[model samples]
Target: MHVKFLIIGAGPTGLGAAWRLAGHGENDFLVLERHAHVGGLAASFTDRAGFTWDVGGHVVFSHYGLFDRLLDELLGEAVLRHQRESWIRVAGTFVPYPFQNNIRRLPPELAWECVEGLLAAGRDAAAGVHPDAPAHFRAWIDRVFGPGIARLFMVPYNFKVWAHPAEAMSHRWIGERVSVVDAGRVIKNIIFGADDVAWGPNNTFSFPLRGGTGEIFRRLAARFADRIRLGAAVVSIDPAAKTVCTASGETITYGRLLSTGPLDRLVADQLVGAPPALIEAAGRLKHNGAFIHGLGFDGAPPDSRCWMYFPESDCPFYRVTNFHNYSPFNTPDPDGMRPRLRALMTETSFSGYKPEDPATLLDRTVAGLAATTLTAPDDAGRLVSTWEMAVDYAYPIPCLERDAALGLIQPALEAMGIFSRGRFGGWKYEVGNMDHSLMQGVEWADRMVAGSRETVYTL
Candidate 1:
């Protein structure tokens, strides 16, 4: 089979590119997806008990007008807007999200420590005596947040979430993700106990009212489904020859190729006879896997909070989301024959340094809920549904070596007429959100058609 434009991985990135192609009245393109459904890591499903769970915690906030308009068209009135109510659990207390901003919620003494550190940090910044750039995430935390807040929450909480010590991570990729502390606002909020929320674009987000996060992608894929080949996993690719072999033992050649899977896998494993240094660089690419554990319970009223972070060692899971609070449609209805149930979703990370056994993860996640005061004794006893899923490429870890490795591999692939684009394709967590990933696809399609520059996934 020969396609004018051949694509791999029918997730958001591929679908986004395909949609752009369709918008331009180009229908000769075909998208090859390994899975039967779309959405990649953003996918969602309803369990046997009729409870919907996302791949993990997924909320939609846009940084682009095209993506916003696409959602408006696909979801229309069914889109549900939400106010962000995120929190963090540490020192046996639930502090507001971005823990540094709400130090007053901590115990008086610890809160004092955080305040003192913030003041000291402010003093340092005023003096203009800090590193031009932090050596790593750990140094960045200590420098930006000061030692008090870093030790109390930033260090430990980030450790759990990333499943790697802060020192192992690079500070280059946290462009807009990390919230910097504002001493004046922090002091004001602390003095009067005022909630200083609404920090980022996600302060107010939107979701589908009916389906889980997947519904958005599913609806988008519907527009270009005729060009999508589901369950067509590409086993190998001959980049030099511009051909891909699917699992069905069929060979498909393409004029231009855009792959949305892991860049490391494409170069090292899939692309036959790639450069040795590129393969070695691909090996250096690091990622943390995810284990999602969900619990549904029979309850009258669920916790109204959106999501909470864990910085302590009390819980194996780094972050927990009150999934039911995101949407009532996430759980089953409470008719006379059935009891309405609320849901809790937790995610644990695993890497060589912080390995997690899938067998014990479910139990550990349940115990973690109780350990962190998320569940009461009564609520713990009455269980309704439990489900767990794993994604191999949860986070593309931005290490000291990540960009250097990408600097080597991406250029080589593009030279061979391949455009690797998407979350893992670009491997830039800073630009790896739903909006960024989709735009990467859209821009890649535009670049292919009009010789435009690809900004988001630039080599």
Candidate 2:
């Protein structure tokens, strides 16, 4: 099949690109999705008991005006807008989120130490002793919030998320994502004994009121009609000839290619020609996959908090989301007949330092849940339905080696008339949310069609 644009992956970004391309009256494109479903990592599934679960934890906080309009146009009034309430489980206490802002919750001794550090940092900032550029994530935190908060919340919490120490991550990506504690506020809070919660603009986010996030993609693909081919995985991409071969033995030639697949896997296949150094660096990009352990219960949502961060060492999973709180539709009606769980599913694999087993996984996640005090040990066994889904690409690990690696790979792909965009494609941890990913794909398509500059990937 000859097409103007050949896209891979039918997830939000892929579908968004296809939708935009079609809406622009440039409908000469075909999208190939490996999975039978439209949404890639955003795909949702129902347990035997009819409770729906997203791949991991996905909530929408639209960055662009166009995104909000598109969502409203497709899902109509079915989407639910919820107030986000997130916290962190630290030292056996549920600390309000943006923990740096809530240091009053810390024990008296720790709070004093943090305040001392912040006072020192405030003086330094006023004197302009810090460097103009932040070298690493740790330095960035320390300079902005002071050393004490960095040691307590920023350092440990980031370690849990990135699987690497803060020193290993670059600071160029920390803008707007990491909260910097204001010295004035910290001192005022210390005097007034106030806790800083609800510090960021993302306190309110939106989610589809029904059918999970995947519903957005499903409807988008439907709008595109036959342009999208589900269960059609691309086996190879020959950039020299501008053709892609699918697993189903179909060859598609296109004028432009916007690949949303992982850069490492894409180059490993040599489907498209990339520089040798880039391919080598692509191999060096390190990431740890995730196993989402979703539990459905027969009662009202557990807590108003949307998600909780785990910084302590005992828990295998870094963060757990009380996803039901995202929207009323996430869980079934409490008064309605809650179906008995028909089965329990557990998935396990090796990614990090130690290999995890399915049996051990069940125990670890359950125990972690209890350790974080999200659940009781006794209530662990009562989860009628539990699902453990292992996703190959979950949190993109921004290790010390990541920047150098992506630096080599991205330029190489750009030279081949291929734009590798989206979460895994760009491998950018910052701005790697659903909204950013969708814009990444759309921008790439726009860049190809109208010579518009890439917005999300420039950083």
Candidate 3:
């Protein structure tokens, strides 16, 4: 198929580009998705026992109006509005999220430690205390939250979630990604035991009422169904020829290309003639994989919590989503008489830095859930279905050298008629949320057709 525009990977980014192109009366484009479905890393699945599971725990929260309007249009009345009630399990206690702000939930000694550190940090700041510029994530944490919060929560929590030490990562990508503590409000909440509901961008988000997160992208893809070639994986790309060869051995050419796959995969694995330095830089781009373990219960959950974090070392999972709570349809027997019929999706990070033994991962996850009190003791036998999914590129680790690598790779691809944008495409975890991913594609389309400046991906 020859077209004016060729898109690789039919995820949010590719869909955004295609949707935007269609808005411009430009239909001479084709989106090639390797999988039989859209949504990319944002896809969802149903287990044999009838529990719906997303790629990871995805919630709808947009920084762009375009994304908001599109979500409203696609999901319509099938949206499940939710108030985000998230928690952190530390010192064997469930504390409200933004662990620093809710340090009072910790034991009195620990709480006193946090408060003392906060007061000391404040005093230091007042005394014109100056420290060296924070060049890494660990230092940034210490600089912002002081040693107390960092030692108690930030350092340990981040290590568990990222599966990489904070000292090895860069701090530049942390723009509203990690909620910084408000010392005054934290003290107030701590003194009064106030449970603050609103915290992050996803404090109030929504999901599909029925089909998990994938339903949104499925409906969005139906808009230009004819132009989408499902299960068409790009095996090779010749930038000079402006053509892509699929795994099925079909040769399709395009005038322009927008890729939503991993930048490393495109350059090192697919694209021919990528610069040597670009290839090396791509190799240097560190990212961790994810093992999404879903468990379906015949009974309800321990609590009505939306999601919770496990920062301690005992738990294999960093975060566990009350999948059933997201939508009743996520449970097979939602209307069934069982008191605790629900689903819990746990995310475990795996990479070279944190190699996970998959054979016992599910076992570990179940134990972790019980240990963290996400499920009841008897819920083990009640597990009707256990589903495990692996994502090779779950998060783009913002190492100290990440931007330098992106600088070398993206411009080279752009000059060669390739615009790589999305969560993994751009690889900027700060702007790598669902909304940001779609907007990256939308802005890319706008940039291509109207010469508008792209913001999220910053091309």
Q: For candidate 1, what's the RMSD? A: 1.5
For 1-459, candidate 2 gives per-residue lDDT tens digits of 899988888876787788778767898999888887888888888767656788877787878888888888888988778877777777668778888787778788887878888888889888989758777778878877777777777877776666556676778776778777776787687689886776675878878877888888778788876888888888888888888999889989988888887778888873666557767787788776767777765433346677777776777776777766655556555233554221212222246643456567777877777776766567655676676687777767777788888777777777787777778878887857888888887887787778888877764
Backbone clashes per model, in order?
1, 0, 4
Clashing pairs in 1: 157-311
lDDT of 1 by residue, 1-459 (tens): 899999998888988999998887778999999998899988899898888999999999999999999999999999788999999988888998778888889899998888888888888888988848778999888878888899888998877777778898999887779889777888899889887677878999898997899999999998877888999998899987889999999999999999999989898879988889999999998999989988988863547789999878878998899888788788886232455577899999888888998988887777888888888757767778898898888998888889899999888888999989999999988899999999999999898888788877765
Tell me the tens digit of each residue's lDDT in model 3 across 55-168: 988998888887889988998898989888988888888888878778888899998888887777778767767566677999888767888788878888788778788998
In candidate 1, stretches whose alpha carbon ends up further than 4 angstroms from where it belongs are: 334-340
Candidate-wise lDDT, in order: 0.87, 0.74, 0.87
* TM-score for each candidate, following the candidate numbering: 0.97, 0.91, 0.97
Number of backbone clashes in candidate 1: 1
Query: For model 2, where is the 10-residue window of minimal lDDT?
Result: 340-349
Backbone clashes, candidate 3: 4
TM-score, prediction 2 = 0.91
lDDT, residue 323, candidate 1: 87
